[model samples]
Target: MLSGKTLVVAAGIFLLGLVSFGEAIMGGSEAAAHSRPYMASIQAVEGDAMKHECGGFAVADQWLMTAVHCLPAGPNGRKVVLGVHSLSQAEDTKQTFDILELHNHPQFNPDNYDNDIALIKLDRPFNSTEAVKAVAFLRAGGVNPDTNAEVETAGWGSLDNLGNRPDALHEASMGVVSSTRCGRSDYFGRKFTGNMICAHKLCPDPCDGPHRIVDSCDGDSGGPLLYNGVAVGITSNGGKKCGQVKKPGIYTIISHYTEWIDGVMGLQPDA
Candidate 1:
C-alpha cells in the first residue's frame, strides 16, 4: 500500500536540508544522572571532535538499536557514548565504543521511513556497571501497548523548535496514539503504516503555546520509546515542527522487526 520510491524522494528532500529531521524531547525535563543507563549517544566523529547526531539504546552487551536514517550514507565515522547523562561533563562511568558493524533493515525505505530501524554492533562488549546496562526489548508476537497508554522517551535532542539542545539528557512522558487515528486524513494520512507507532501529549490549551506539548525533535532520532520499561519503539520521524497539534511523533515499532533483530544478533527464534 506504500511506495518506497516516493518515500526515497522525500528522504532525498530531507537530505538536501529542505525539511528538518523530527527528533528531540520538547517541553521535557532533564533526566537524573545516569538514570537511563541504556541510553546511547550516537555521535559522528569529525576531526578532533564528535558531534551528537542521534540517540540509541543498548540492547545487548555489544548491540545497540537506532533508526537506520541515523547511519551515515557512506563510511560511518560514528561512535556510541554510553553511561552518560550530560554530554559536556566527563563522568568516570562513561564508556565509548567504535561501531564495528551497522545493520540496517533490508526492507527499510528512507523516503517514507517504513522499517526505519537498524542495529549497531560495538567493537566489543560493554563493561557492565551501574551506569551502563542493556535494555529489554519487545519480542516478535509481543503485545503492543494499547492506545492512550502512558509511555516514556529520553534523548539529548533539541528542547524546542528553535533548535535549542541541552547538554544533559531530557525525557518526556506521553501517551500512545492508535495507528488508525495517526493515519487519518488530518494526521499523517496514508503515510502512517502498521509498522509505525505514534505518541504525543496534547497541550492543556492551544493558547498555551507549543512548548506545552511533549515530543521528540531534531537530534533525538533513533532513541527508544519505552512502555512498561520495555523498549517498544525507535524514534523515527514527526512533523516539520517539534510539537505540532494533532501531529504526533512517529516511531518504528520494535516488535515488528524482532525477527530481523534476532538475525542480526545471531539468535535463533523459538521453535
Candidate 2:
C-alpha cells in the first residue's frame, strides 16, 4: 500500500521545486471523444464536486486497473467517469459508476514504488458501447516489445509539471526504455525495480529545461501505457521533475502481473 509519509514528502518537494510531478500525460495532445474508449477517470467525490485523482482503464465489465497510490487514504465517495473526453461536458457518450471496492496489492511498497498496482470494482457493470469498452491485454507468452518502440498513453493530468489540470483528455506518444538504462545509478538508481517499466520521449524539449524529453506528468498515474492498442503498462512514477529527458516515467509492468490480476478479477489465467 502507498504510505502517507512517502506521499507527504514527495508532495512537499513537488510544491517546492516546481519539478515534474505525478502521472499526467504531460506532452500529449487532446484525445478525441471515445477514441480511447477504455480510459477511465478515478475521481474522489466531495459534496457535489468530483476531483480527478488519477487515471485508469477498464479491464472487465465491472473492474478497472490503476496504480495503488491513487487510492484515497480515508473513506470517500469514490466514483469513475467513463467514455467522456471532456471533463466538464456531460455528453451522451459519458457514463459514471460508483466504486464498490478497492484492492491494493498486498505487497505494494510505496517507498520504492514496487508493485504499485491495484484494482477497482464498480457497483455495477457497464454495457459495451461505442464510447465505452474494455481494453485488450497483452496475450500470454506474447513477445515483449523492444526498447524504444513507439507507444501511447492518455490522461487528463497537468499540462506541465506544476500547471493546472486540463479539461480535455490528453494523449501522448513515448518510447520504451531498457531496464539497464532505467536502473542506472544516475537515474532511478535502486528504486527502479525490475517489476517496473520505464518510458519517455526520444526527442528533446526546450520547454522543460535543457534537452529534457516529454513524458507523463502528475495526474496521469494509474493510466494505461499502451502498445498496438493493448495495455502493457500502468503509469506509476517519474523523475524528480516532469519531462526530464533522462528521467523517464516509470510504470508497473502489466505483463509481469497478469496472473495476480487474473486472480483478483476471477478470470482464467490463459484468458
Question: For each candidate, what TM-score against the reference?
Answer: 0.87, 0.85
**lDDT values of the candidates?**
0.86, 0.82
lDDT of 2 by residue, 112-160 (tens): 8899989999899998899999998774476556798988888988777
In model 1, where do residues sit more than 4 Å from their true spots? 1-26, 72-75, 205-211
Candidate 1 structure quality by residue, lDDT tens digits, 1-271: 5599989987898664422323323357889898899999998877798889999999999999999888847326788999988887878988999989889888888777899999999999999999999999999878888899999999998887778889999988889988889999999998899999999887543313433678888898999999999999999998788777677899999998877888889998979
- Please state the error at residue 248 of candidate 1 in Å: 0.6
Best by lDDT: 1
Q: Which stretches of candidate 2 lie over 4 Å from their true place?
A: 1-26, 72-75, 204-212
RMSD of each: 9.9, 8.8
